[model samples]
Target: MSINGQPEKVENIYLTTLNEILDSIAPQNDLELSLNSILKILAKDLHFQRAFLAIMDPKSEKLKLSITHSPAKIDHVTYSPGKGVVGRVYETGQAVVIPRMSENTDFLNKAFGRSDEELKSLSFICVPIKKGNSKEDHNVLGTISVDSPILPMDNLLEHKQFLEVVAALISNQVSRLQEEMALQAQMLSQGPLLGGQEVPPPANFVATSKSIKQVLRQARQVGPSRATALLRGESGTGKELLAEAIHACSPRRDKPLVKLNCAALPAELVESELFGHQKGAFTGAYQNKRGLFEVANNGTLFLDEIGELSLDAQAKVLRAIQEKEIQRVGSEHPITVDVRLICATHQPLEKLLKEGRFREDLFYRVNVFPIFIPALRERREDILPLAEQFLEIFSKEYDKNIKRISSPAIDLFTQYHWPGNVRELKNCLERAVLICEEEVIRTYHLPPTLQTAESTATDTSLSFGEAVAKFEQELLVDSLKKARGNMLQAARDLRVSYRIVNYKVKKYNIDVKKYTGAKKNK
Candidate 1:
């Protein structure tokens, strides 16, 4: 094939490309999915002839082949210990590379039974994977082998080294997964908390979606520790609320949890806000004032929009975290503070780092543990429950008798894509509850955008209509509510005549006499 009219294929898989693929699969909670994605990328995207991993079955104690490339059909079930190249790599815990498959007697044509012509040009590479990271604890559990027939002869060594790096990554992931599964099993065996009641999720947060549940799991895991948590998501996705959950479940719950928005403060006042200034620090410094770092001593300090901090502010924050102390502005005295830091950002810190706007050192310091809040559009399962919760909250606050959302209103609630996430949903429910005169909130009582076709312009599928008559009916009802069901007064408030108001009220089947006896808002 190399001597034909076509040029030879080169092996040019870079480490960066491999890392990018692994990074994507890192978030996957399923072990089978992660392994399939790894092999799929190797065969399909990396242009390999065949790729597969042979993991040892725990009960059978034999190396069994996993899912392979779609083009190749291999019927071999399990390899005996120290038998073929695959078994030899697993038994001895060392990788093996065959420059020419047909030349080696251990090539084992019985495994795949390819033609001699194909075996003459094919190169085989197998790398053993260990169960743990330490070399002293070498428990060979599997082997990831690849058949790269199209590669040039000189690139075999580089490819072997690349496979070793991949095997190391596989080892790390397997070890972590095994430990996590063991811990979970042990916890479940301990049973529920006191009174047989299940441990409730974080307070004031609904986690119906799997994505948000995973975020909550990650947050609670790091709560008791002093590790800095980085909450990442788009604006209004409740990063601040998640910060509160982390602190509430943490050991610092007894201490005061200080909060600050890095973007809300002026650039000149950022340092003074983070680290206090002396009484005579600057022209405006009349009296000594402690900063957030000092105020949140022995507690959690949540810094929202940390990405908006200036480069100089980032440097000082990094120092405070590293040294466990901070120097106030225009003051040389350093005060020690024991604070648990939780940083949040809606902006991409990596993009800012590459653009020279953010310090790379500070970026690494705060990115220790990251929890991403799924956007409302991605977690639609939580919408109805959240809407109901907000409905109850606003009803009590506004002294309204609103009980539930109507079926049509619920349909519109789930159909519309919330761009502002939980914050927007809260506001939408609050508005709906306030305007709702009847026990239930109707579709017309919702925001105008939700009823229009604009809601469908985004990711949603509903291109619902907004009827002018429905809106006019709502206006008439509201005016009647304000006027205590009096026709002349309601018409004056609506800027229409009494005859037109009476016609609309009768046309919409409105019972004007009921509102007259009920207590109304001022």
Candidate 2:
């Protein structure tokens, strides 16, 4: 029964252990218990010193240790993508086999306190839990790994294949558990509103800026009414967050608040997505489905990126708004819908109308109570508070004790223009939290772009007006240097009038003749 010099007894042990693991997992059984049981069996049968499972958090993009077989109690541990051998396996969607853990530089034993002498004799194997059959899909669900001192280098390939099989067997169960967790979270978010209680705005909606506060006030005022509102703002300015807040404050808070992104769907399916489709309405339509309008009856339907809708789709949307009814595709009867509409877009509807891309009639219907959300850069005062908020979230998420951002890091955050707005700031803070090992986040923890901007700026402590003036002066001097002290050329380079450039040169008190002589000699 033995293929190699290894005894057939060991091969039987592997098969028996795998079959037992498979039998232990049932649909009704607790997911964590089943996973822990499997890990325990692997540790015992394979003589592994340690076995563990780490699941990926889709929101924070961090791997959280879920189950471990070691006797020592290891509290919650998390790893960023590409941080260690386990992270590398998750990131690359490939199994890794390290015959000697000590020789591998990528092996980080920070979570488990294994001594250097112990690590030198240990071997490790990690495989990704993928959702799809094809390697091209590369949709990794999580990772499973085992380490032991008894694993022989010659049998490493066989162990790797065996672990990959185990990962494949458990992938579907892991995916189901993750989906259930997400659904539970969504239901909890809406639970208070459903219980006939007034739910306050989400705590994450941090707005100290006067402009954003005014926007929130306007949203609260318009929430009780049935009028369709338009949310106009730049991308990543938290328009969707405002929409959710409005829905929470509305009288129909108990009802469902369905959201759809117009840009995410195709033109052909837009109509069917907004308005329900009957069976046989199109190819692959095996069953009838309720559209967003029907699902959001007596509630709110927030359409994000509304400008991406086609003209035909726009007509159908306009009809739904004006008539308060939607006819299902391939059906004759028009179903009455009492859904409140809230549309958001980053594009200029006026320009779309002039270009004949958007219908003018539809514009007036949805623009009844227009609320404009200011970008993050427009409200620089709120940057630190938002950063601190994100830092707390990510710190807890990664199981790190990071307390605060350093003063230098805060200065850099304020000086940089957040092109992606609040979303960018949130991501930046998440990254800083991941990279920072200390209790405080420093400037080096931030992205290189923010660091470069901070290095180039002269003084971040200046008031907003003074900072703007300094920036203007620097721009004028740099332009003059490039134009060889010619004010007219500098004006053309800087895209300003010659008179204004001359005034800026005198205002900054620059020596233009030095540059002129250098250019003349060249």
Candidate 3:
């Protein structure tokens, strides 16, 4: 079969590939779906007379033939330890190449019940699958053996090597798949917090998609610079997290990090909060107060919601940043501050400047370096992992024994649009954990907004269930980030009872212990 002159059979199998199998496996979470799918595709694509995979049993010390592509009407055969080439190679954890069929006695001829004479024209190759670690324990997870009659010696060896490569690929893919799957299970079961995993960046930090890697690559560049940085994105896109990350990676990481939420503070307090005030400078000022600048002296100060600052406040900020000194509200002398400024805003500063809501000079001052964070919808690939992370966090916080987010719940999450970005997703999952009674967070427990958004988007062809699932997945992961895997604390932050939270812990089956905790101040 041919499609556009390419092998149609091969194309069909490759095109039929699904990521579900990959989603089912995790580090210790073993599932055979991914391995099976790869073998299926390989067998069909190469038109091999017989193809099958065998993974070594963890405790059995025996090679278990997990998948087979042999013709029906024949029972599948299992080789005893070191009985045949496949078993011997698996046992020794090395590659064994059979140059010719009749040369080796250890080469069993029991594949698909084929007689030795009939199988004589066929050559085989087997290689052991190994895991990465200092110890490098050799385990024969399985063998990918291909049989072909009337094949050339060179072609046979090449195909053998190719099959070995496929085996290695399967091993790696399985490892990732199992890890991801286990993470998902843990996220859902454990209420997004269990065993104390470090909370991840917000769901708005989505980067699982192919396109978002470039976005992250660009964002990473802004960290080392002394120039003022501007981060632009939709609200809930986790501008603050990115800003903090930048500060953490900067040269002044050892200094205090002062954050000013320009939008949250009143206009009267903005100037004083930023530049400091002398005693009796204002009606409530009985004593001198160090502003964010003084507090962050020689460190980095994050100015969030910069677009919300009034022109007057913006002017004061501009002066201190440009001159490296700030005069107190009622003081005669200017105090020097060696602080680095990193600003973030969801609003389009350029548009605001054009509309006269933001000052152009201030814009230019902070815009010396700009980092744009992509929205959750833009980087759907990161959704599920992030969600799993959140589930792990919340599970532990709520003190619930929940294990994971149900498959359907993940599917639902990936389908919705996160209008509020990571923040909104965090609220939604917290709510779900509060309401869910099962070990897993299911579709019924999802936020009403998510369901509504998914429905509306699907109706208009604007989004699909799969997309929402990805979004929710990211949000769930983001929520687990704050506590560094301390599920009980995560639950308190979410304001949910411990039991419900623990249910999610069990449902997602997350191991919070693996979450890397936040490093202490160096």
Candidate 4:
């Protein structure tokens, strides 16, 4: 039977796979069972004698087998990107059809223990499983190989095409499963909170700022309660990250962390997308859809950019929050959703509330635990560390050898007003990495805005090193003042350690202790 010609069977399998994937998207799945079944189905339907899935090592560009089964071998086996026929196929992104293995010089006989005399009788088909660019980059995710006793290679093209299609399917499911499993594993590792309602914290969260520390403390304090949280910040100040941290520390972490960007979805579809719709609910509503609230039942619903929601959608969202129930567009039955709400927005909600734009009641409901993320300019101490983080991130991202920022470049970054905040800084570093030809990013690699400021400095001959020291002094003084002479608080505010802040205070010769008069209470 020709695998490609079985259109009805293939269609059924595809539909079944899609449904399974969609169901797996929800949090109520046993990931291991789902993955095991997915692999089994793919292997069976593809008629492969042996099938395996591997996850690509991001740094090494090598495939390490994650799951597999063979009649001869019990489980998956390890293979590098250039090892055997499987590796060669994955590395080259081309199908290898070896009718006679002994005749093929490219064939590596490590998979089969048979000698050249015994291998000459076998035929094999190896294909690479990859996404996005299936050609050229050979960003090989994994590979699938099928072998049989010496039989004439029949319809090699058709078999190769079928293998490629199956490879794409496997890639999609495997990537999704990996992400879900990783997230779930993290959630499970975090111990339960005091109350049954609080979620745990995400492991990747890093905080050096007192404001962030206090925010986390507050979140932990009230996370077990049913209070709504509002995260206020500039873009890239990690509002979403804070939200995730809150969710991880809450009781709802076991369920879904449903996210909705109010500004991203169209206004016309906002209501439907958030509240979902029943069949024939509107013009194109042919199927019943579950909204974010329902999807996030017994969990958290993170509404990002909440200030961007239209008035109508806002009213609907408010009702949903207040009543703990949502009415689908065409369905009268109100579905109860036990979800903790977390919202974030760059817009000033108080001003919007005063202007009658944001609903007062809704604002009150979500503002129970409001936390503000200080901009990069406000927290000057975080600049260097954040820059270092970005340098590491983008260096690995762009595969560049850049290790550090020069004194001049660091000065330019420190002096520039980061109006766009942390998000903009990351973008600048990413672009710099792409264009920088040297081992380090210099002032010239920075954006023109930053470069212009350094160029126009009054004391250019002071040396970039001296200029940087002066800037650091000014920044330290400003931060100390902002913290009202509380050195620990100031250091925390700057995302720097107490020692560093104290050292800077001594270096600048600022009598911070003297400034700690009556203003220390605030």
Candidate 5:
């Protein structure tokens, strides 16, 4: 008989197994160890061939293998959202049941390197692990899946429901683990703490986006070589930061890295600034000087806004790059200088070359290895972490103790378009730090543009259910604040029974102590 149609004995056995699994997850045990243990029990008691958990990567938006009960050597496996059954469950925040893997054409068995023949007769069930009632909330963290060849197909619905309950039980633990990981990362980024003061460590490139990571990997690969690298990105996308990272990781790290902004200087002085000039070369040429080429000899010279260089300056730069020699503006003899060039530009160099504003040959020389840094809007997953880093920095600078960004503020941050990219984000956080009075930054502390955008977005995008949920949450918070977190009083004020209010509080996972000034008696 199918498990669903079996006697009460089978139902009792299932409940007992679930309770045992839940009880085994102790707070003191390692998360992975506890999860694996539970999976083993599930595989044995539930007659499943294999069970596994996959956690969603917030940056890449991919589901990565976390723990599995199978003995097969499956590691380093990842699936993009909507790629496989597990991924589809993660993407849609819904449960999926496959009665027979062979019949389902969409079933991709690549997650564990299993071929179609191996999974032909298996049945699969995948369910999302979420912390909130609303599937649209950011609380859908990951997915848990199980498969078995001998399991009855008629009880697929029963199995799906049971897996969902298991997922809900595990969601709280997963959320706690995620919070701990975030805290540890923040502490590491802040460096060692001595007597309540933060000793800042040397800055490093911070990014979690997969695209930026790929760019950084390419930078590291080319750092050890003498190849000319062209960094192309919009303004405020941190081109200079990538340039510095390259220089620091290069073989000439001990040598000086010279930087000059072509657009910042006058056209008349551009050539002189780059090639230097002899004593009395021009009206204000007071003494003999060394050019940037000589200063950066055996090191890297980062030429910012290379597209802004005049044709005259471009010719001299090309010659220096080609022959490894430069001539002082008024000197006859050419001086040999060895320097690696790193160029950056916000403008499209190809278009500039076509317009005769840039030298095509010079462009080829610099574009040997081009790295494109994605704009902030293109990598929204990095937004919160970057904002937190800035918050730590400006909080220290302003002598404030701001500890965190409120969830609502972070929601607004992820929604708004970052026109100015990372630079604008830093400035925004700095301003919020200066004006914030509490330890948390709220939505009101953000710029007016964010507020306007959020209002417009809510009006047009939020569904009726989502809008109702938002209003309900706000009402609960306000009621709790007024009642000093006394559930009885809050329910009376809202004209609801104490049982209903308590249920709602638990459903939302609201922390009652946050609304009350009272401390725990324990």
Candidate 6:
């Protein structure tokens, strides 16, 4: 039924036997269950001693035994790349079939604890399970191996070929399950905040700096309370992310989280947007609509750019906080709300209050629990960690294979003063991932803002050893150019022995044909 299609019979019995084995596994979706059933079938119908499937862990990059069925129930087994037969298959993407396990020197039988007598009578078959369809575009996920009894007239090559077909049929199932299980396992391990240690940052938040960790610690401490929190930071400093973190770990996490940007709306519509308006209340108020406060009842409300709210809207918000009620525009009826307020502003409220632009009563209410988020340049240590996190995210989003940032690019990242903060850094990395076509993001691939005199310069002498090597290589090349690629004359011109010149030429791996004007080799 497969592309390997109906194999011609070596004899009557073997042909029927191979067909039964192939028919038993029909590409089921439940990978572990299918593997368990395949092991039972191989043990019963084919007299196979043991069978196991090893999958590569994406995080650790180590091969771990994922599924096995035998007398000893093993939870997990790890093998370094190119350690034994199974490891060899995973590394080289090649099949290995041995007549006797005892004769193979690399067979470490340490995981299963097989006896010497059992090893002497058993054969081994290991084959790689790759992802892509073609040989040039595939990644070897892991290996499938089995132990068979060393009986008379048993062809190991036939068994190896059969196992290879089975591996190809189930490669997709293996990749999906491994990633899901890894993510679930991580979520379960990061339980609740314990002791007085640094609180874990929520998803989409990266806080490796001491300044940012302090902000998270305060957020965790005040999240459960019903107090109003005022987040202070510069523009693009991720104040919204901090507000979401507080809401995610709070008691009202399951309820709706309503967000509004005060500066984004027009000044005249600020009140109607926050507390709603009745039908025909204003020029465009066609019908009655529920405001953000009603939607955020028994939940949290994130007001970004809160400093930009008009004075009339500020007084109404203060009344909502003090009395737990709001009146829609053009309506005197009071509607109660039970919302936990979280306000963020990149501007200083003290300056606004001094200028009579913000209400003093509302400022005191929201500023009860204050947390100031630092700018990206203030926490320079988090540059690379945050950049790498963004690199991985955008690589998957754009379906690009850009792997890592080069050394020169990393130097530019840490040295640049991020006037636009974390949001700007995220955009820069996303652009880099989109434009980068290689396995690594070089300095030339970064944004123009990051392309400084240092990064874009063509100086190869960045170190003492590098400068010496550059000087020495240049001297040797000049001597060769003058001597027409003749080693003996080049050594005489440079006042060195021919043997020393020969060693330096090979050390630099220089080709002399261009310098010789396409002359014959000496």
Q: Pick by TM-score: which candidate is best?
A: 1
Models 1 onward score TM values of: 0.56, 0.50, 0.49, 0.49, 0.54, 0.52
Q: What is the C-alpha lDDT profile of model 4 across 177-276, one tens digit per residue?
A: 4443343344344554444533333464445555555566666655555567788888888888888887876777787899999999899998888999
Looking at model 5, report the run of 10 residues with the lowest lDDT sum: 193-202
Clashing pairs in 2: none
**lDDT, each prediction:** 0.77, 0.81, 0.66, 0.70, 0.80, 0.79
How do these models rank on TM-score, best leading? 1, 5, 6, 2, 4, 3
Which residue pairs collide, candidate 4?
Answer: 197-251, 198-250, 198-251, 199-248, 199-249, 199-250, 199-251, 200-248, 200-249, 201-248
lDDT of 2: 0.81
Residues 219-336, candidate 3: write the lDDT tens digits. Answer: 4445555657777788887777777777776778788888988989898888999888999987999998988899999898999899988898888788888789888899989998
Q: Give me the runs in candidate 5 sitting further than 4 Å from their true place.
A: 1-202, 454-522
Q: Which ten residues in a row have the lowest lDDT in candidate 2?
A: 191-200
Candidate 6's C-alpha runs over 4 A off are: 1-193, 453-522
**Superposition TM-score, candidate 4 onto the true structure:** 0.49
Arrange candidates, best lDDT first.
2, 5, 6, 1, 4, 3
Best by lDDT: 2
lDDT tens digits, residues 377-447, model 6?
Answer: 89988999899899999999999987667555777898888889999899999889988887667677888
Better of 4 and 6 by lDDT: 6
Better by lDDT, candidate 5 or 4: 5
Error of 4 at 360 (Å): 1.4
Better of 2 and 3 by TM-score: 2
Clashing pairs in 5: none
TM-score of 1: 0.56
